[model samples]
Target: MPTQPATAALFPGQGCSLEGVKPLVQRECPDLYELCLCLLDADPFERSGDSTRYTQPAIFLASIARWRGLVRRGVRAGAFAGHSLGELSALTAAGVFSEPDGLRLVALRGSLMAQADAGGDGTMMALLKGDMGQARVLAERFGVTVANDNSAGQTVLSGSGEALAASALAAREAGLRAVQLDVTGAFHSPAMRPAVEPFRRAVANVELGVASAPVFSGLTAEPFSNLAVELSEALCAPVRWRETTLALARLGVERFLDIGPDAVLAGLSRRNVPERAVVRAEELDVTA
Candidate 1:
């Protein structure tokens, strides 16, 4: 008998684009593209670029299209994990919601997030060569929030522009690369609080159920059993990507497939769990 593959599908959140993905899953999985047309009146994969509103749905399609391709090739991962917006993709892939429904939810999510951006001077910055302790120290000192704990050496700080600028300066002074993200608002921070209620309201209209396959939650860094509250709380909670990936590794996931636009999560996994194999699903020769 063939050995079971100890693999997991990793989905990425925002700040990652799928401007020109390979193999062009659009021709195959037109459902996502059609939904993008319905929602934005444009092909997100083709024109989204870095706009937060368009990027959300585009990333979903980018990730889900690869997921559909994997399913066609009979590659079934033991578990699924997503980092933020990726969580919704995971939920959709696990069948918690229909593809169209998932796209709709992400569209509304993107809009609310855009509104939050226009509401104030929010921003996000990346801290290179910083660990949890150092990031927490900076967060406290600069009054910023840890938007994403991507890896041991990389953390994203989010909050008001002033705080982000100050935090970036501090990182540079400490011999760290501080790069401001292309995103508009301070996602995964208290600055996103305003977007939460509207988002919650939107999710309420959409029916959510338990996923058919186990999905690791970005909020709890564990398998998600509930959707309603976890998603609501996800708004202001930092993405625990490092711990979440480690949790999958502990669960015997020897390999990780980043089923999304960029190989970011795969790269993060390689660095965070160097012993594990990480690759983008689309790049894999699924035909073989």
Candidate 2:
């Protein structure tokens, strides 16, 4: 029989929707569910799910809950990676901290990012059918920042709304499709600099433990050498997700399990490693 491929667990960022994850969290991780309710003062998935203050914690809780379910099913991963805000979930799942700490950190991060973007004209847009080279050219021409290198063909730009709009026009003119993201601010760019120091302090206070499995940073595509520093710097640094995905592949990850509410990371994995197996949390029959 052919050998089963090695697996890596991936977590999604703010793009994840909380549509079907509430029940899973309630069922598999009631403590997390209750904690989220207490932290946010409401069920984020049921309340203002679009707000960063709610979305970040909601996704973190859902991802961790799914990770717990995977653990119960004996699903082991050789490594882990998360996109943007999902990095906290990855670290927690890797045993760097307790789930409660992760949840609290995520809540603070969301609140800080939201406040940083408050009353600002910052936003994000996706450049599709374009490579990093083209994205860089647009960024240079329009004074935007390459926020997310999501895949070979999809890169996200973040900056002032006017700058992003101009970049979007230029991308479309260059035959690439540009779509505006629903985020409230220019995340992963200079606009988030205001939140960096505060988040850094919060991360520093947390007691971090060595990870059970290597957790690659989306900011650098490397195993985390210093959690507090990297997590803080990641606020304004681009998410090098494409590089991180390739790094996992180079590390012999032939299967990717996206332990988040949505299959967004699984979709990105397919784009990065088409020959490899990609599975979403929803696909696993963990109910047994």
Candidate 3:
């Protein structure tokens, strides 16, 4: 038998649409879909209308459903990594907790993050054609913070509405394209600090198990040592995705499977490690 490539399964954070995932989940993982409806008290398939409280759990269910399909096909990974909100999904996939337990935690995390920025004055913006140096300069000038280092060329900043606007204008003047993200709060910034302790306490209450595979932390670009503490701290820390991808490559991950609602992570993998094979769940034949 041909040896399987060293693979890492990646879960994406928010900003991608869950357009066709409902049908996929309903067809392949009905129990999880129903559980989502029961726990959330709404149709998980319906549009979230950009509400973080709804989008978080919806994304989690979609990712897990796709992962289950992969598992049925005997696909496996050596490691796993998730971006921001996707980390909870990664933990569940790695057997750190049950799916239902993960769902409940994500639901509460969403609610806390949403409530943390009730005024809705906090937002995030992406900076393109810029390096981390420029991103840091703009962030310092505007009193914002770098939320995600998605790739060498793409960085996201999070802060107050006024700060983001000022940062965007500065980025444009500096010859970088600035685009505002369709998110509800300044995630990975000080604006999310209010949710940190509550989320930490909630994570502590859950029963955690040894992961079936190593799960890398976006905050530290290393395998998780303390999930509860790291997960909560991740709320206000930058997603070192570029570094995380590199770390995975260092660990001999030659194939990256993006097991999420969309191809967001796959796209990032291509840019972050072009030599590696990147596959999206949608591209796989799950009918077997």
**Top candidate, metric TM-score:** 3
Worst 10 residues of 1 by lDDT: 19-28
Off by over 4 Å in 2: 1-4
Put down candidate 2 lDDT per residue, 1-288, tens digits, no spaces: 666568899988987677867787788788888988898898888764457898898888788878887888878888989999889999999999888899999999999999999998988999999999999999999998999999998999999999998898889899999999878888999888999999999999999888989999987899998888899999999999999999999999989998876678888899998988999877897643
Tens-place lDDT digits, model 1, residues 174-259: 88899988877889998678888877777777877667668998899999856767887898899999999999999999889888
Q: List the residue pairs that clash in candidate 1.
A: none
The prediction achieving the highest lDDT against the true structure is 3
RMSD of 1: 2.0
Candidate 3 lDDT by residue in tens digits, 53-136: 889988888888888889988899899999999999999999998988999999898889999999879899999999999999
Q: Which prediction has more favorable lDDT, 1 or 2?
A: 2
Clashes of each: 0, 0, 0
Distance from true position, residue 243, model 1, in Å? 0.7
Superposing every Cα of model 3 onto the true structure, what RMSD results? Answer: 1.3
TM-score of each: 0.93, 0.95, 0.97
RMSD of 2: 1.6
Global fold similarity of model 1 (TM-score): 0.93
Backbone steric clashes in candidate 2, count:
0
Give the better candidate number (2 or 3) by lDDT.
3
